[model samples]
Every structure is written in structure tokens, then in C-alpha cells.
Target chain A: MLLKVKNLNAGYGFLNVLWDVSLNIGKGEFVALIGPNGAGKSTVMKSISGLLPPKSGTITFDGQVINNQDCAVNCRSGLSYISEELNLFTGMTILENLEMGAQMLEDKNKARENLDFVFELFPRLEERISQYAGTLSGGERKMLAIARGLMSNPTMVLVDEPSLGLAPQVTDEVFNALRLLNRQGLTILLVEQNVTKTLKFSSRAYILEKGKVVLEGPSSELITNDHVRKIYLGT
Target chain B: MNNSRSIKAVEWLKSSGGITVTCTILVALAVSIHKGPYVLVNTLVTGGMWALMAIGVSLLFGVMNISNFAHGEYFMIGSLTAYYIMHPLKEYLLETPNSFLAFITPVLGIAGATLAGVIAGILTDKLIFAQLRKRNREGWLLNCFLITIGLSIILINLHMLIFGNTFKGVVNYWDVPSLALGDVYVSVDRVVVFFIAMLAILFFWYLMMYTTLGKKIRAVAQDENGARMVGIPVNRVYSTTFALACGFAALAGGSLLFMFPSYPTVGIAPLYNSWFIIILVGFGNVAGAVPGGFMIALFQVVTRTYMGEGWENVIPMFLISAILIFKPYGIFETKVRSVWEQ
Candidate 1:
């Protein structure tokens, strides 16, 4: 497996959000973690990405146990995380933002190749290279955020809700891009609220509630689960 | 980043800042034209340092949310550094006014002062603020305010104990004569200081706009999580931000060493003046501080000319009070949305 988590318990301050949540994903696989609001889905992503230290449990990535390592170290180790905040330098231009994403590259020359790849993924970024990130439309901002994550050229990308506040068409564009990326042999761990769409793209899915994982299986099987369709799917 | 569109607040410049600016310019022009160019030149000279100090304050409040009560201490450190360097060699520098040695001496002192400020900043941030950051910083704003106040007091007392409150400053780093503008003449030092401030602001702007380091700083300022997500070290950026702000303050102090002498209590006024600019420009409006500094300078110069010496301070206070009563947000208002956004 490219990534594995066992008995993960984490949260902010006294309120422990994730409780014994465990999941795993092999290389080149697309996996989804879907749950209701405050289901600790994002919390699990944060622990794995090293933004939040797990209260207890081990997060093994690429055969290495990265428990106390920070986000910067994880990023350098080829683990890219696109947070819900997007964190685009609002005062900076798109090009400058891209350069920041590629700042960890040991060789400056490779940054150009990464830039080309991200620009190809989101061409509107090229057209508006000089414009400030603050002015980008919502859909374009999501694309830029994802594109920025890709600029790191990570072994695995943990994306938290790329579709949030985005239209259906833009969400499809982002999902299709992720599917294409998974096919190209990059591991993806996505935390999204949209269940049906997530199950459609990802090979496997995990259902989380409150602070624990309730169900975990292949997306093909989970999509047909009665419990999922009744509550999450609102059918 | 949620882009929920809301009604933009009425900018102070379109109204109050506009009035203050237009009135200051009109009054300054008429007064200076009638009384000679002394007022205009003095405004320019004094305005330069004020602008630099204000920019530092703006960066602190906007980027780091550090209400630095000891900002002036950094300036004092710079001035002290410059005084130490220039005082002993004052004679040699005055003798060879245009020599390379003369030029480099002041530059070296200013550079040293900036280094001193950075060192002091690291001590305060890494040793103190970083620890506070590690804990529950829910009341961080109030905590930082008190901590900086305590820092200001400690530094002041420490300087008094060591340096004995004696005013120490150089006559001049160079022997260049004053420049005549119409009926009045202004010293070469003021012009140099003004240009230095402009250049520093320009350099800072370029660094922030183009460099990856700049992006990291801005990213940390906007959102720590965002910066972390992108692999930018947030804690390191915090320390760097504090250091940069202190360095800027120290540079201002060093450059204006001829005017502001080294004293234990020297930083207090500059700190207040910096806050004045921050208030006039809206707290954290980095770009607005430039003009706001000059506006404050003009008010001071004009008030001192017409009213007297101490009343210059009173005018700004009264004006700020009046402005606040009407447009409390200042010129370019920025609402604090999150812990990082402050």
C-alpha cells in the first residue's frame, strides 16, 4: 500500500475528532473518504498530510512511518496536500504562486517542466498568469489550487473537497482530471462530501461519521449499499 | 478561500483621507510659498522616516498581527548602532565628505543596525512569541499587546541602566552643504534619508511580488494552514516576519541617526507616529502607509509652525479622534476574518 492508517485518533484541543479511523490505499489507486458534516473526514486527511499530529495511531506513507514530520517535510518527501482553504497567495500572481509550489525542487530546471504540466492541466492559469490570485473566479481558484498541488510532482496527493463551492461542470472537470491522474499511476486520497460522484470516480470508498469510520469497501459495491443511498444520497 | 461577495466598505481616502490630504497639500503649499520652502523641505525630510516606520508597522499588523509597542526600540537600536559607528569617525567623515569611506560608513552602520534589530527580533519572537504560539493562543491579540508593552518597558529600563539616558548622535556623516529650494535651503542628509526610504520600499515591493520567499511570507500571513499545505514552514515564516519588521524599523533609525539621537525613551515617539500612520491609512494597509506617513508629517510640520512645539502632537491626536468618530475603519479598512488573516 502507498498509504496506511491504523487506529488514528486526532483533533483540535480537548475535542478529539477522529477515533480509531483506519484506511489504506495501494499505489496508483483512487480512494474516497465521504461523510456528513463534522464527520472527521478532513481530520483524517490532516493527520495523514502531517498538518495535525495524530493523537494516537500510525500514518505510514510509501513504507515510511511519518508521524511527527511536518507538512513541509512531507511535501519534500513527495506527499502533496491541497487543503480546503486553497491558501493561494491572494496578493501574488498565478505564475508566482506556481513558482512557490515548485520551490522544494532540488534542481531549479525541473520547475519549468512542472510549470508546463500544471499549465496544461489548467490552461486558464496561463492566460491569466499576471493577474492576481485574489481576482480569479471560484472555479478557476479551485483549478489553480489543484494545479498548485500538482506542481510539487508528489507521489501521492491528498485533496480535501476540490468541488466545494464549485459548479457541477467545474467539479466534473476536476474529478475527470483526478481520474486521469490516477490512471497515470499517481495515488490519490480524496475527502469529499459528494458521495455518488466520488464513488463514480474512485475505485474504493470509506464512510466516516462523527469521528470513526463506519463502512469501508470497493466503490462499486458501496455505491449500491442501501444505507449510503438513503442517507448520503438522499434517495 | 471562500469568495462570498459582500458590500465593500467605504474607503477613507474617498472621503476623510481625501479631505485630510487635499487640505494638508493646500495649506502646506500656501504656507510654504509665503514663508519660504522650509516647510515643504522639512515635510519631505521628516516624511521619509515616518513612511518607513509606518510601513514596518503596517507589515507587522497586517501580516503577523503583532501590535509592537517596542517598534521604536528597534529604531533606537539602529540609531544607536549608527551613532556608535559615526561618532568616533565623525571628524574623518566630515573631512572627506564625498569619499567612498564616508559613504560606506553610514551604509555599514545602517546595515549593522538592521542586523541588530533582526537579532533582537529573533530573541523576542523565537524565545517568547513562538512559545506563546505553541499554547492556546485564543487571546493572542490581548496577550501580544501586553507582552510587547512589557518588552518595551524592559528594554527602556535596560538602556537607562546601561547608557544613562544621555542623548547621543552624530552631527553629520558627511560635510555636504544644504540644498536651496526657492527661498529656503534643506540639508543633504534629509534628501538622502528620503531616497533611502523610497528605495527600501521599492526593494521590499519587488521582493514581495516576485520571490518565492515573498510568497511564503504572504501565504503565512493570509493563512498558516494554506502555507503549511503548500510546504512553507509556518513557524519559520513567523520569525522571519518579525525580523523583517524590526529590520525595517532599524533601517529607518539608522538612516535618520543624524536627526534622532540614541536614547532609552527615543522609540516611544516613533512608535506612536507609526501607529498614527497606521490609523490614518487603515491598520495593515501596507501600500497606504507611504502617503499616510507624509500626511502625518505635514500635519506635524504645519501644527508646529502655526501653533508651537508640543501642539504638533496634539493636532494628530485630535484629528485621529475626530476621524475615528466618523469613519472608524480608517482609509482602507480591513476586517479580521481569521486568526491568520489578522
Candidate 2:
């Protein structure tokens, strides 16, 4: 396993959000974590990405325990987190935002290489590089956010609700991009709301509710499971 | 492309950059009609110091959510640093006019004053603010303000104990005579002070725009969590930023020593001036402080000329109060770098 979590218990200062939650992801696996609002899906991503410290249990990434490590340390150690809020420096230009993303890439040559890759990943971003991010269209901003996450060229990417507040067509375009990245051998742990689309492409899926993992299995098997069909898929 | 370009142009006019250009033209026009070169130079000198001090307050508030009432003390520290070092070296230089020590003493004092402010700022952050940052951040803004208040009181009393109420100062740093510009004589000291202030501001601009640490500070300023996600060390950035802010305050204090003098309560007027500029800009932006400081200094000069010397602080306060009541976001623009900014 490239990432492992065991009985993780965490929350926001006395408000226990995650309860003994345990999960794993092998290298290069496309995994989906889906749940209702306030089901601790985002919290799980926050803890694993080291944005929120885990009160108990352990998170080991690439064979090293990474529990309670600073977020920057996690990013430096090959982990990139694209948050739901899409924290792109709105006051700054698209080019500057991308440059900030590559700040930790120690090797200037690799950072330059990644810059080319990012511009290529989203040609729209390249064209509008000089424009302030706040001026970008919704779809372009989402693309910029994802492109920023890729600037580090991380080993694993944890993307939380990349489709939030996006149109269905734009959402499809985003999912396609994610699918393309996953195909190129990037380990992806996605927390998404669109369950059917997520389960269809993700190799494995974890169903969380009330801050605990209630069900976990292969995506293909879980998609047909009666409990998931009733509560989540509305089939 | 033209459409987008126009949009960007419009955005620029709304930004701090646009405001600066507009204010410069207006001030220049007003100068051509009424104010002479001497008045212009005076405004610039006073304005430059205020800009340096106000920039620190604005950046600290915008980034760390700190309302540092104690910021004035850093200014005092600079004054003290320059006074102690410059006095003896200056005396020796005056006795022996051709000596190298006299030629370099002012520069050394200036450098020492800024360095002292930075050290004091960093130590304060590491010893006090760093401890508070580790705990829960609820009411964090209020807590920080209170702590600064306590710090201001403690520092002021400490200054009284050590330095007493002595008004230690210099008439000027260099012995060079004032230069005449269009029948108006401009003091060499004021010219030198303005030059240093501009240099410091430009250096600050370069640091914020170009350096890696500056990028981190800007990132953290915009969004701390976002910066952390990109692997920027937020805590260290905070400490460095605080030091930078204090360093500027110190620089301002040392540079303006000839005008303000060094005393226990000397910082009080400077503190008020900084707040006036901060409020006038009506934003949490460092860039706005430059023009805003100049604008306030001009207002002071005008009020001083008409109503004698005492109304300098009084009228500005009343005007600001009126502005706060009517257009609270700020008079120049309704910019949102407010401490209460969500």
C-alpha cells in the first residue's frame, strides 16, 4: 500500500468528525470516497493531507508515518491536495499562482518542466496567464486549481469535490481530465459527490456516513449493492 | 482580446495601482496652482515616513489579523538606536571634519536602527505571538489586539524607566546646507530622508514581488491554508513578516529623528499618523499606504498653515470620524483589507 490509515479519530476541537476511520490505497489506484454532507468525507481528506491533525490513529504514506505533519511537509514529500474551496490566489495572475505552486519544487529545471506540463494540461490557462485568477470563467478557474495542484508533480493527489458548484458539462470535462491523469499513473484519492460517475471510473470506493466507514469494496461490486443503490444512487 | 484587455484596464483603475496614479496627478495639479517646492518636499518627507510605518501596520493586520497598538514602540526603538550611535560618532566627526568615522557614522546608525527593530520584532513574535498561534484561533484577532495593547503599555513604561523623558535628538544628520529649488529652500536632511524612504519602499516592493520568501508572504497573506497546501511554511513566514513590519517602523523612526526627536511619548503622534493613513487608504493593502500617507501629510500641512500648529491632529481626527460615520470602508475607496474581512 502506498497510503494506509488505521483507526483514525479526528475532528475540529472537541467536535469529533472522524471516528476510527481506516482505509488504504495501493500505488496508482483510483479510489473514491463518497458520503452525505457532514459525513466526514472532506475531514478524512484534510487529515490525510495533513491540513487537520488526527487526534488518534496513524496515517502512513509511502511506508513512512505522516500523522500530524505540517501541510507543507506533506506537499514537499510528494502529496498535493486540491481543496473544495479552490484556493487559487484570486488577487494574483494565473501565471503567478502557478509559480507559487512550484515554490517547493527545489529543482528549477523540474519546476520549469512542470510549468510547461501545466500550460499544456490547460491551454486556456496558458492563454490567460497574465489575467488575474478572479477574472477567469468558472470552468477555467477549476482547471487552474487542478493545474496548480499538478505544479508540484506529486506522487499522489487528493482532490476534494473538484466538481462542486460546476455545471454538468464542465463537471464531465473535469472528470475526463481526472480520468486522463489517473490513466497516466497518478494515484488519485477523490472525494466526489457524483457517485455514479465516480464509481464507474474509480477502481475502489469507500462509503462513509456519520464520520465512520460503513461500507467498502470494489467499485463494480459496490455500485450494484442494494444499500448504496437505495441511499446514494437512488436507483 | 481587446474586450478582456479593457476589462483588465478597468480592474487596474480599481486597484491600489490605479488609485496611486490618480492621486499623483491630482496632487501635482494642486501643487502647480498653490503649493511651492518647499511645501512639496516637506509633504514628501513626512509622507514617506508615515508610509513606511503604515505599511507595516497594514500588512500585519491584513496577514496576521493583528491590530498592533504597540507598533509605535518599534518606531521609538529606531529613534533610540540612531540617537545613541549617531551622537558620539557625530561629535567625534564634528571635532575632526576629515575623519572617515564621521563620514560613515550616519549610515552605520541607520543600518543599526533597522536591524534592532527587526531583532526586537522577531524576538517578540517568537516569544509572545508564536505561543498564542499554537492554540485555538477563536477570538484570535481580539486576543492579538489585547496582547499588543499590553505590549505597548509595557514598552512605553520600560522606555520611561531607561531613557527617561529626555528629548534627545539632532538638528540634522549631515552638515550640508539646504538646496534652493525655485526660490524655495529644501533641507538636505529632508531630501536625504525622502530618498532613503523611497529606497526602502522600493526594496520592500522588490522583496514582495521577486523573492521566494516574499512569494510565501504574499501567498500566506492571501490565504494561509492555501499557502500551506502549496508547502509554504506559514508560521515561519508570519515571524519573518512581523520582523519586516517592525523593521520598516524602525527605519521610519530613525530617518525622521531630526523632525520628531526622541522621547518616551514621541511615538504617540507617529502612531496616530500611521493610523490616519491606514484609515484614509481604507484597505488592508500595503501599496495604498504610500499615496495615503502623502495625502494625509498634505492635509496636515494645509491645516497647520491656516489654523496654526495645534489643529494638525485635531481636524484630521474629526474628518476621519465623519468619514467613518458616512463611508466607513474608507474615503479613497471601499477596499476590503479590513481586520474584520471574512
Query: lDDT score of model 1?
Result: 0.84
Mind sharing the TM-score for model 2? 0.94
* Per-residue C-alpha lDDT of model 2 across residues B1-342, encoded as one tens digit per residue: 999999999988887547655775576557646755565777889989899999999889888888888889999999999999898888877677765675677788888899999999999999999999888777888899899989988888899999897898987887777788767788888888899999999999999998888878888888788898988888899999999999999998898888888888778888889898888777576888888788778778767766889999988888778767876777556457533543
Off by over 4 Å in 1: B1-19, B91-104, B334-342
**Clash totals for all candidate models:** 0, 0
lDDT for position A51 in model 2: 86
| Residues A32-104, model 2: lDDT tens digits | 9999999999999999999899999999999999997999999999899998888888888898899889998
Off by over 4 Å in 2: B1-36, B337-342
lDDT of each: 0.84, 0.87
* Model 1 chain B worst lDDT window (10 residues): B1-10
TM-score of each: 0.92, 0.94
